[model samples]
Target: MASERAAAAGVLRRPRLVIFDFDGVIADSETIALEELAAEMTARGAETSYEQARALFLGMSTARHMAYISEKSGRPCAPDFPDVWHGRLFSRYSTELVAVTGVHRTLNLLDRLGIDYCIASGGSVERIRFALDCLGLASRFEGRAFSAEMVARGKPAPDLFLHAAAARSTSPHECLVVEDAPSGVMAAVAAEMPCAAFLGGSHLDPIRTRHRETLIQAGATACVGDHAELQVMIEAR
Candidate 1:
């Protein structure tokens, strides 16, 4: 009985909206992004492996990525670094990227369930659109995408998630965040939103268990392994 009450205290019951993180949650773009980013940094003399890149910059913007590269290389990245990355990444995205394995099907299910969802991502609006369009998800999220570029502070701060929730007319406690980055999970927690730490990606395989535990410790309400597991949690909630 005591244990049951402890579990009950953590339940959200029903949230009015779902906020998805872009790169790793809805789109399988993290691995692709990290690979290309690592190569880009290497060309600038800041060589890094995929694992290192992911560790150093999982939920940062392109500007931040370039800054890190510049810092590491001890030379500033070109003024056109953002444009350069956008062109390169988008070009490859057209032929190489896809949505998270079962996300389209999961979105369809959410549609059927009458649940409202929008994206709140650290990626720029243009980059988010490119990935979603590549995955044929543009129409579903047409006017509903929120970018960290719109806010003064990004992930690990509650600004972006709170902005997203406010734009959707939902309060923080009335939302659930599906996040694949520790910083994002922390943001959700700070916003008072229940977080579902997602471990459903090629990029997350190596540190999946460690990440899951870390997120739970960071105040995630749950840790889900795949879209199917997320769907189950969604339906139950």
Candidate 2:
């Protein structure tokens, strides 16, 4: 496991491949999605708040999130819930989504440094592609985006990250994962890859310190305040 002390020391090995998480790490879309989920639950008579929704569902898979909603509301989610929810979410994403602050600069840095990078997100492939397209990053990540749907298990498990590494033909030790959630940090650790916990997402603005602590405890090798800090970390020897 990665130690917080080591992470705080600000020393990290430069990696050949950088694996980025999509929603909160690359695209500034978590706040929109969480707010929408809270509103949707409230309209369904569950009375959920944005904070509550974020705490409960931030890193969960779609099926797991629906199951959680059903358990919390004491009613099963409609069978078509995923489809309907995604449609609504994508509609909103088209108008409101933007890339995370400093993400483009960070990617440009990676390009100049000659590091290979790809997206390995918990979101569906379709969602990932749509978001990249919306952010005008589709061409940059072409043929390099991976989704959890392709693996047997999602975050908190090593499967998806490992699958991504194998597909990219990169060794786990040669990969660095950039994530904004504890589950993703854990997944990276379990995959034996170093992870930088990103705290720049708007959804984390109100709880950045707490989330940073949580992610460090979850085995992140470092905590980055934003993509600028991330670039510094990546540039470190």
Output the number of the TM-score-best candidate: 2
Task: Give Cα distance to truth, residue 140, candidate 1, Å.
Answer: 0.5
Q: Give the whole-model CA lDDT for all candidates, comma-separated.
A: 0.83, 0.85
lDDT of 1 at 227: 88
The parts of candidate 1 lying over 4 Å away from their true place are 1-10
Assess every candidate by TM-score.
0.91, 0.92
By TM-score, how accurate is candidate 1?
0.91
Candidate 2 lowest-lDDT run of ten: 1-10
- Residue 156 C-alpha lDDT in model 2: 78
Per-residue alpha-carbon lDDT of model 2 for 1-237, expressed as tens digits? 225434663656899999999989899999888887787777665778999988877766777767777887899887776676678789998999999999999999999999999988888888888888889999999989998889899887999889988888999999999999888989999999988888889989889888888988999888778888888778775
Clashing pairs in 2: none
